[model samples]
Structures are given as C-alpha cells and as structure tokens.
Target: MREILVRNTDLSEATPILAVTEASLAEVLAGLGQSAGNWCAVNDFSGRPSSCLLIPSAEGSGATVLFGVEETGLPHPFALGAIVGSLPKGDYSLADGFPDPEQAALGFALSAYRFEQYVTPSRKIRRLGVGKDVDLDRIGIVLDGVKLARDLINTPANDLGPEELAAAVAALFEKHGGAGRVVVGEDLLDENFPMVHAVGRASSRAPRIADFTWGEASNPKVTLVGKGVIFDTGGLNLKPGSSMSLMKKDMGGSANVLGLASMIMAAKLPVRLRVIVPCVENAVSGNAFRPGDILSSRKGLSVEIGNTDAEGRLILGDALALADEESPDLMIDMATLTGAARVALGPDLPPYYTHDEGLAEDIAVMAEAAADPLWRLPLWQPYMKYLDSKVADINHINTSGAGFAGSITAALFLSRFVENTESWIHFDIFGWTPADKPGKPAGGEAQGIRCLFDLISERYSSAQ
Candidate 1:
C-alpha cells in the first residue's frame, strides 16, 4: 500500500496553506490576514483534467497547492488520484474546506494503490494528509479491501491460479475468524461439480470451488458467489488476441465478492455470510471441451457449449447450485460474463439481473448512495428460449434465436441453477476502467462492491 493518506492537525500555526483560483484565493488569503498579491500568480487556470498550480508562500517553506477541476465540480475519485500522484512526498493539508470531504479522502486512498509484487519500487515513499474531519481508520479499512480486490484481479494467471486465488480468499477468511475450505482438482469431479471441472480441466492449474462461511449459524443467510476464472483463454472456440489481452481480470468477480465479504465481516454484520467461488482457468489444449460439446452441471442441467468462450457461466452454474442447496435468504452472484453486456452498457455501468423487484430496488438505491453505479436489466423470461438446445438441456451461448439480449440470456442460464432462493441477483460487470475517471483507475476495479456493502449494512446492521 502507498502512503496516500495525509493527516491534518487543528493547530492554527501549523495549518498548511492551499491556493485556489484567483477569485477563491482572494477570500481565503483575506481570512488568513495575508495579502493575495504576495502569492505567485497562476495565469491559465482552466478546470480540466490533471490541472494544477503551485503558489509560493512568503517563507518559501513549500508552495501551496491549487488544483483545477471541472467547473461542474471535482471529477471525483479520479481527479483526486491525479492530484495525489502529482504531489511531492509530504504531508500537506488543505487550508480551506473541501466540498465533499468523504469522497475526496476516499479518492486519495484509492490513487495510492500499487500492485508491486514482482519488483521492488525505486521511487521514494510519498505520503499525504487529510483534513481533520476525515475518518482515516475507517477509510483505511475500506481502501485496503478495495486494493486487495484490484491487486488480485491485476495479477497475472501464472502467479495467481485457481488455488492461489482461493488462498487470497482464505487469508480474508482467517483474518475475520471465518471458516473456509477449498475443494481442488479431481475432487471437483468426485463431488459432482462436473461443469466446473469440464471448463478447467484443459489447464494445468486445475479448478476448484472455494467455500467460506462466517457469522452465527442461526442468523439470516446471505450467500455470494463469484465466477473465478483466474485466466480465460476462451477454450476451443478461442478469443481473438485483442479480446484475450485482459482475460487475467476474468476472475474480477471473485475478487469483488471477497472484497465485499471482507467489509461484511469487518463490520460484524448479524447475518450469516457464505462466499462460494469456482476458481478455474479456461485454457485451450487437445483435451479442452470444444464448441458443441455437452456437459452435465451439478444442478442436473445438461448444457451445450455453443461458444467455448462462454465459460464463466459454466463454473458459476456449479457454484450457484451449491449455494442454492443451502437456500440462503439472499444469494448474489457476480461475473465478468459477456461482451454483449459491455456493448449494451459500457465498462462503468454494471448491469444486474433479478426477478425480485423489491430486492432490485434496494440494490439500485444503495448503489447510488455508495457512488457505485449499477443498472438493472430485466430477466425477460421471453429470452430464455434463446438458450434452448436441440441436443442438450440448454445451450451455453445463444446461436441465433432472439439475437439481442445476450446479457439477459446469460443471466437466465445462471438463474436456472439458483432455486429455492427467492432473492437472487446476478451482476455482469466489466471489472476494469478503460480510462481514468474520478476515483476509478485505468486498471482493475471493484464495481458494485460499495453498493453491495451498503445494502448488507442496511439490512444486517439494522437487524443486529
């Protein structure tokens, strides 16, 4: 973790100076009993991306900072990142009040994340300070979990295979005193997790289902399942080179579920929590399952592989079946599942599916409040026929029928595996920000995580 957090004190003499726009700077200078004319003049101050101005103080100890943001407001999360990354290594506090202190602080923490495992950093440590009102302890916990998720997704498959991914989750489980187990390799075949095994057997790393449980046994159960394709080669159908470049992030769903689970356990929510991740790597080999091949799922459903690239749902099918067997009060599954979903909605907006209107409404509301945006797409039972298979019970990918609504069809496939659970939702997420934006970086991200955290907090915290 980078030293992104800057701690501020209340002492008047030790207050760090901030240089805003000429107009705003005049008022702040006057309040401090200092002349605005003494400050260095910054001529071009357009509120744009990565804009900054440094005005020297009389003592020349260090320059005060003036960051330009869009006239509309701070670009949020991303803008704060650019600011922190550009600043020198030191603790500098804002002389004036920030419009949204919480968001600004959160953005600073997020920008400090770095995945530096292979090589050590040569650059000196950079530290930052926040305003007195910001809650550093709480922000550290949240950002640590979020960074853990991004690091897991950002790591390459060779270093972070199915077993390694399970180990990451187990660390969180142990940290929270939760129970966790990993059922590996051939055990998947013996335990009736055929879909999970079929999708991963081509790879040397092997596939497994990682299960974790926490909280009291008698409490209302909330189960989360994530599609943990550590690396996706698109199997026999094969993805184009351009499409395969970022496939290491296919396990982003598992990373996100573990992130949210960390939040739930850290807060000590009353509900019993269960996290199921079917970790795998869909690789191409002679023995790899090909298009038109049929595989029986643990849920007793036979699925035909219309496109071998559509393997996320195959592993998720087995995990969902296992989660559904427990019949938790609520079950949610997240996956970086389909390209069609990315076409319908872009990378930033995660599309979710749910049959329960009330649960959907709650998720949407909480998502907005947490600033983790999500859009709800209908299950649209009419699209279910698109996945109908002539030889097998169902098709993994729709070939021709209802050419549209691919995301809905994929969600519908996983929906079959989940029975007895009245409240079930599936999230099709990009898990990567293509470009830098307020708060979100250009690399791996945890979409809908904060929203899920807020939803769990509201329901479970209130019950306790």
Candidate 2:
C-alpha cells in the first residue's frame, strides 16, 4: 500500500523514464546529445537488462532517467521493477520507447511493496505519474490483492494463529459485502471435518474451517480451497532448527486464495465464488496425532498417517472433499505441500496438477500472460499405488517409496477426495522467494494467484 501514483499530472511536466535496449542505445544516446552520451560511455552503460543511469541537465540537476530493457523478444512485464530501488524520489512518466506503459506502472507499484508490519520502511520509492492510457483502477485492484497476501504470509505465528487467520477471512468477506462463516474446534467433528480437527487438536489455539461466499448463486460455481496450517512443528515428527525456521509460512496457501478472492470480488467477475480455508496448527503435545495413526476423513475414507509433517495434504483432503460435494464448475486447491516440488522446479515456478488437459493448456497460456509461471504435472494414476495402505483406504504419504515423486503422490492423495468435481487443479507452491528479485522480495510471496485470476476471469466473465 505504498503511494505509487501522482494523479492528474501532465506527462510533459514529469521526468521521462526512457527504456533503452542494447540495439537502441546509440540512437537513444544521440537523442539525449553529447554530455549525456559521454556520461553513458564513461559509466560503461551497455543497456543490459536492469541496468539504469541517471542523466544530468546542463545545470547539473536531474533531467531524465535511462532504464535498460532486453535487446530481443517482448518486453518483460516486470522490467521497470528494477528501477524502483535506484530511482530518486520524484514524479516520472514513461518515455516513448517504453513498452506496455500500464504494465510498467504496475511493476513500479509492486516494487514499492515492503512488509512493514513490525518495522518502518527505511525509504519511500519514487512515485509515477498516471498516464491517460493506463487502467489505474485495475492496477489498484491487483495491488490490493497482492499486498493482502504478502501481509498475511509475512506476519509471525504468535500474531496470526488459526483463530486469527479465520478472523482475517471474515473481515475480508465483510469488506466485500459477502457472507462469511467459521466452524471452529469440536464443531469441526460435529461437521464431519475429522482430518482437520485431528491434525489441529493438539494446538491450544484450536482448529477451524473458514468459509466465504460471494456473487449470485445462479452464476457458474467456482470453489477455492487452501491449506491454512498457521504453524507446523511437524507434529510428532519434529523438524530440525533449520527446517522449522520458517514454519510461520505454512498458511501461505490460504493467504494466496484470499488474495485471489480479493481480485475476483474487486473486478466483479460474474461467478459464484466460494473460498474454504482449514485453519490449524500442527503442534506437538500429548494429544498430537502421531505417525501410523488411522483417522477417518470427511469423504468417508480412512487415512493412515505415514508422516506427521505431511499434514498439509491431510487438511486439504477434507476441504476438497467438502468442495467436491458442491460439484463446482472449477475446484482449485493451493498448498505449500512438499519440498519435492521445490527440488524439481525450484522456488519461482510452482507445479500444478489436473486431470483436465484443456484446462492445463489454458492455465499455461494465462500464466505466461500474467507473468506468473506455472508448470503442469500429471495426476499420474499409476502413482496412486504408492499411497496404498494395508489397514486403511489410503496412506497420508508414500513412506515406503524411494521418495521419487513426492509431490505427485501428495497430489494423488488429495485427488481421491475430489471425485465429484471433474475440473479440479491442485497447486503445490513454495511460498517463499528465497532472495529478492525486482518486485518480489526475500520473504513470503504470492505465487499463482494472478495467473489463476486471469484464467478465472477468462472462463467466467466471457459468459456475462
């Protein structure tokens, strides 16, 4: 929510932001004249992507800024993000050479984001003047969504436990004039969400399932479920210091879904939206669920616990089962489910699973368009065998297998609870960025929400 725009300002009065490519560097330098050209050469400015230079006027005052773009291919949506940190605090406008000025403005706003809930920001980023052609409203909506997700994920567990997480969802729905409800503690057992209750019963804060609904009931039904484990101690299977350091981000999936819901509501997309978040804390206590313990699920299937750390999929299974019963046109579940996915595709690109081939192809296209990348991994029915349990209907994880396809097996386990829904997709995301990059910083990030929002808008909005 940092101020990113100086509204109603004429572009001619603002400093120009010139986006230069290696091929266009000389032409751009010539346009700026001798002193600027010599400054560029002396500074060894080769117009490399993300490289920037500040041009000085004859009076030795700031005149214009030169930003570098790629020499070939379409302009990156986030290319302008690189200049957010370097630019002096002032008002500026995109010059003629910049591509997709609207996107550039968005990148500038996103780059200004900082998780300042605990500490104040050191400095403010330069604000940009809004051009006539830019869709300022749309940009504002997207920024609000992204900031909400980042804030939720960045908060520490002590301030954002299961009850607090549920409260956040309620406040969001209320803001949008939607209906919100929560089934907490033992009420989950009365409501048949056994897996959610069992996994979280050990925590003193108590477990709950938060639900939010919006739009006309006659519209196409789109259900979203997210894993909301507030903090994971790995249950009876405790994690080491290094592995448990960032367990506060266990609810990132829920945060991301809330973010997506914000965009859908803000845009007034014509779809009946339902969001489900199973809020829990996988803590260790005398009553904590242990490995090899058998628990019944909401879908009437028995699940034998293989490892307590794999509790993300367990909570999601029950939520998906409930969502499936609604037979929504599209059912999507997001979770920070496995490290195996990180090993396969790294942290930036999240892998999704779905039985619908056409949906997968469409999502890939939208992901690229939104600059949020996703890889489609098959449900791979053959891997279902790895989750087989001799005493129960399924094992929470494939403990006996050589850990070859951990992410796939986790997806397969959740897939069992989603038989009623044909259009279902599961996202296994690593919510942390690991390091700072342009608009994204080294903390909790919003992964697939933007791309998913684009896909949802295309599928449902066109019908209206």
Candidate 3:
C-alpha cells in the first residue's frame, strides 16, 4: 500500500498542496505574491474541480501543488487524487483551507495503487504528510483492504484459480490469527455442496468453498458470502470475444468480501465474522453441466440450469444456503452476477437488493457517508415467478417475461436459499472500473465493501 502518514513536519521543508475552490482561488493566488499570481493568471487557472496546477518553488527543488475542489455539494473523497501521479516524488503537506484533509490523504494513497504483479510500476507516487486530526491507522487499514481486493481481482485466472483464491483467504486468516478451512474437489460433493461442485466440475482445477471464522462466536453473527467464479467462459453458452475478455474478474465478489473481512478484522469490530466463498471456473468441457440438467443444492432445492452464463448464482445459492443454516444476525452475498445490474446502475454505482427496509435505509445512508455508491433495487416478489421450472424446484435464470428486470430476478433466485435470515442483502456489483476516475483507476475496484464495513462497524460497535 502507498504511504499515508500523520507527521509533524515544518511547512518550509515540504511542498504545500492548496485545495482551491472557485471562490477561494483569487485569495490563495494573492498569498503567493505577484510573480506566482501572474503565473496563475497567465496559465488561466480558474480552479475548476479535479484540476491541478504545479508551481515551482523559489529553490526549484520542490513545488507547490494547487488542487481544485467543489465549493458545495457532497464531499469529493478523491479530489486530491488528481495530484498523485502529477506531483514530483517528494513530501507534501495540505495547505490551510483544504476541505476534508483526511479524505484527501486517503485519495492520494489510493491513487498511488498499481497492480504490479506481471509488470513493474514505472513511477512512484509522492507521499503525503497529514495533520493530527487525520487517523493514519484507520486510513492505512482501509487502504490495505482496498488494495488487497484490487490485487486479487486484477490477477489473471492462470495464477488465481479456485485453489489460489482459497489460499488467499487462508493467508488472510492466518495473518489475523483466525481459523479457516477449505473444502475442495469431491469434498464439495461429500460435504453436500452439489451446486458448487456441479458448476465447477468442468474446470481443470478443482472447485472449493472456503469458510473463515473470526471474532467471538457469542457476538452478533455477521456472515458474508461471495461468488468466486475464477473465470467464466460462459460454459456451453459461450460469450462473444468482447464479453469474455475480462472474465478473469468473475471472482471480484470474493475479492471484495475478503477485503471487507480485512477491514473488520483490522478494526476489531465486535462481531463474529463468517465468510463463505464458493470458488469455481465456469468452463466448457465434456463434463461441464449443460442446460436442462437438474442439480440438487445444499438447501435441498433442485435447480435447473437455464443458461450456463448464469452460473454465478448457482454457486452462491449453495454458499448462501450454508450461511443461512447458521441463522446469522446479518447475511450478505455479493457477486458480479448480472449484466442487467450493470445496465441498470452502470459500473460506478452497484445495485443491491433486500427485503428489509430498515437495513436498506441504513445501507443507503452509510453508502453516501462512506462515498461507496449503492442503489437499492426491490426484491419484487412478483418477479419470483419468472424463475419457475416445470421439472425442477427453480430455474437458475429466469427465462420468462422477455428478460426484463434481470437483476431483480437474479436476486430472487438467490433469496430462495436464504429463508432463515431477516437481514439478508444481495449485492450485484460490476467490480470493474471501465474508466479512470479521481481515487479509482480503470481496473478492479471494491464497489460496496467500505459502506458495508461502516454499517457493520456501527451496528456492532454500539452494542458493545
């Protein structure tokens, strides 16, 4: 992770980063003297939001960075991210009048993130010196979780298959002194995770379900399930070349859950955390589960494969069922499950579904506060009919009603396996940032985990 520190350093020794708004730009420029003020005027620096300008110091060894932020509306958590790559490699401090200096420090650290597994990074991100008000430890923990998720999602399937994904979870648990168990291959069948086994039967690597436990078991149980399809070839229903290109990110949901787990453990929240990841690769082969085949799930509900591309929900169905058996105080399953969700909310905003109105409201408020965007899409019980299967208990994908409300239908399908939990919510996330934005670059992104972590922390922390 990039360095974000709360250091007491003299202003003269470090470059200053001034956060300017449209109304404050003139006053800030006037403070810099006539030469710098004239330079700002000559450059036509009007303090447009997300814009950055660099002014050479009198010594010519360091520089003063001007970052533009909006005067009103929601706080831009990543406003300072624009300067991460543009600034020279040196220590920098936020000048007075900067809004939300803590978030700016986080933005700088996040923007420095680069997936350097296969290739080395060409340049280093400049470090930031934050004030005493900034919680450096909290920022470091959050950045560590976000970077962990990004690194997992960004890795290619060749190196990060089902076994490797399980290993990642085990390593995390080991790091935190938690216990974890992974059941793989025929053990999935032996353990009655038929849906997980069936969906992953065709892959060269074996399928697995990793269960990680942490915190006191007596505390409020918060269980998280993630869809870990390492690669989706669309099975017998092959996707087009364009659609299959980024299939390596199919396991983004599991990556996100692990990331959230990291945050919870780091914060030492007062809750028993259980994470279930159904790892698989929906590949096409002779043994690949085909359409019209009926598979019995861990919940005892029979599922008929409607479309092989919709295999994410099938694996999650078993995982959710297993989690439901424990009757946790709160249960959440996140997946890069549907193109329909992406179409409805786009890549930046992920849509979540839940029957609980109170939980939905809390999530909405926390999402805005945490700057992790989420939209609540209704469960719409009426859409459950679309998943009807004449031969089996349910169809994995809804084939009725011209495919309208696809994301809602997908959530309903998973909801069938989760009957015991009242606080069950499902997140259908895109998990990929198609374009570069202020704190988030165009790569694997952790969509809703931060908000979820905030919600979990608040809910359980108050009980203590």
Candidate 4:
C-alpha cells in the first residue's frame, strides 16, 4: 500500500504519453512537423499495436512516449499496460487520445506492481498522472488489495506458514477497524475444524481458522471462504518436484479473500462482510492424515480422504460449512485447488461454478466489465455420483482419478458441504502467472476478486 499512483503533478513538466492507432498515426507525425516525421521513419516506428516509439523532446531531456493502440480491439482497457514497466523512471501523463482512461489507469497501477522484498529491483519509482476522469481513490484501493494478494502469494512458505497466514488475516481486519481472532493448534479440533487440524497436523506449524467481520450487522451479508493451505507437500501422497515448486501459492485463495475484504472495508461499502480462512499446511510426517481416513466436517458430513494431495477441499469444506451456517446473502469460496481448471481454461481465465443462473449471469457481466476474466463450469448434479463413497458420505477427491473432469468433481465435492446458502460461487483459480503479461507479471496473481467486488458493490450499494 505504499502510495504508488501519484495524483497531483505539474502537467506541463510531465512526459506526455501520446496514444496512437494506425488511423491516427499520420496526423500525429504531421502535427509533430517534418523533423518528427524524419525521426519516425529513421527509427522504423510505424505505430503498430504493440510497438512503442519514444521521441526525444526538443525542449528538454526525457522523451514523449508514442504508444500504439490496436484498432480491432477499440478502447482496449489495458493498452497503457506496457508503459508501466517499459517507460523510463519519471513522471508520465496519458494524453487525451485514449478511450477508457479509467480502466487504462487502473491497468497501469496493476502493471506497476513488483514483488521486490527478497532483492532490490533495478528500476526506480515511476508515477502516472491520471487526470480528473479516473477515480484515483478506487484505483489506489483496488491496487492495494491486489498488491496484498500478490505479495502474500509471492512470499515463500518458509516465511509465511500457517501461523503467518492467520496473522495476515488478523492484520487486515485490524486495519479496517474490524474485530476477529484465530483458533489454532489442538484447539481447532475442539472448535470443530477437525479437517483443518488434520491437514496441518503433520507440519510443525499449527493449523487454524481465521474469522473476521466488518460493517453493520443489519446490512446485507457477504461471507467469503478462502482455502489457505500455506504450503502443500501433498501430505503422504507427495507431488513431484516440478509440481511442488509452486506449493507456496496454495494459499492464494486466502490471500485473494483478504485482498477483497480490504477493498470492501476500505471503500466503506454498506454490507456485513465476514471472511473465513482455513489456514493449514499439508505436509508429510508420521502423523499426517492418510488416504481412506474418514474425516468429519463442521457441517456434520463425513469425507473419505481419497488422496492426501486433494487437501485444499478438506480445509475449504470446513470453512464453507462454517460460513454457510449463517446463510449469508452471498457465499463465495476461492481456491488454487485443481490443475484441471488450468487445463480447461488455461492460467489466465479461472473457472467459476455457481448453481444459481441469475447470479451466474450477473457475475459473467461484471467480470467482463471489470476486465477480470472468469469462465463458468456447471455444478452438474448428475456428476455428483463421482463423489459417492461407500465408507463415508462423500469422497474428498474423485474416484475416477485425474482428467475425469477433475475441476468439475472438485466443485461438486465442495457443493455437498454447502446446503444452506442459495447464492454461493466457487472459484478454482490457478493464482499464478506462468509468464509476464501486460497488467499481470510473472508470479502470484489476484484473480476473480475484482469482478466479485464490483458485483457486491452493485448488489449492496444502497444498503446500510
């Protein structure tokens, strides 16, 4: 939350970011005079969509940025994204040529993010001067939330274990003047978070649940449940080294939940917001929960552990059941749970599951508007047969094994725990950027939360 997006600036002194399309390119070069035209030709700057040309200022040192916009995707929101990381360290302002400046500014702030804790980054501070059309307050708040999630997800498990994850939730609630606490260690079993305790029992780090609430009690209720597996060693059924490399990001769901909560509370949205995070580390030890162990849930459902690696759902099941007890107006759970979700929609577009058609349509519309990507996969009750267990009420993982619609089955498993909530959405997010993209860098990412935030804001805007 360091003030990265600068609001006020000496407009005359700032470097101008002149956005151009092929249609506008000629007029721009002509307006700059023959000398500027010569510069463009000599430099081979044709103003293609991805191409950027920097023209040295005749009166001063730093250059004016000439950015190309794709004509096909008119008003591409993130067109200014590349400038964040590419532009030289200085004050920059977007010229009036671009449409959707609000979204463009938001994209710029998001693209500006860097996880620089472990090592000093080479780049210096670069600030954007977004004029009156953009809401700097909203941009700053959303960016802070997104930054929190990315930072938490980027941090390794060695520094951010189960205890640390709980602490982070406590810190968020504290910042927003909300009251909350965590139940940790053997106390979790007594508190009825048996599955949570079972998952983290093997690790030295204690398993726990973090619950916090904000806003007026009488307002519309929105409860968020996030899967907080601080690190996944996959318990007894360990993952190969390649798969284990990103286990630190398993808590991304919790990270995103806290991030979204931060935005809601900071904006002072008129809704009762309750966040529940089941924090655990699925580690290997003599005492780890084994396959075929029928673990009891907070909802009174019995879950037969099909694989120790499918530990995220176990933790989420307890949390979802706990959240559903009150039957909040909306209940949403986020998890970096399934590789199948990544396979189905790739890394960028996370798949969401919702039984309610109206809610699904609203989410889809808002996701598009917010520029936060999501694809809907059915709750498909017919596929619920895949989860049946002879020994227990349900099996935690699909008995059909991998590629048997693993993401769908995982959502189906979570759905069984949630009986009371009519409006519940499940987000199976990968939560990592495999490579660098414009607004998203190569590391931990914040997914689905922004779209959900917009949806919530609209639903409860008039409420107190």
Better of 2 and 4 by lDDT: 2
lDDT sort, best first: 2, 3, 4, 1
**TM-score for each candidate, following the candidate numbering:** 0.92, 0.96, 0.97, 0.97
Per-residue lDDT tens digits for candidate 4, residues 60-87, read 5666778887775434566677667767
Instruction: Report the Cα lDDT for residue 134, model 4.
Output: 77
**Candidate 1: where is the Cα deviation over 4 Å?**
1-3, 10-23, 29-40, 46-51, 68-78, 122-124
Question: Which segments of candidate 3 are over 4 A away from where they belong?
Answer: 6-12, 73-75
Tens-digit per-residue lDDT, 42-133, candidate 3: 88888888887888757666567877878872147876776677777767888765788777787778777888888977565466787887
Model 1 compared with the native: what TM-score? 0.92
Candidate 2: list runs displaced more than 4 Å. Answer: 6-13, 71-75
What C-alpha lDDT values do all the predictions have?
0.81, 0.89, 0.88, 0.87
Model 4 segments more than 4 A misplaced: 8-12, 71-75, 121-123, 401-403
Steric overlap count per candidate: 11, 0, 0, 0
TM-score of model 3 relative to the true fold?
Answer: 0.97
How much does each candidate deviate from the true structure in C-alpha RMSD? 2.7, 1.7, 1.6, 1.6
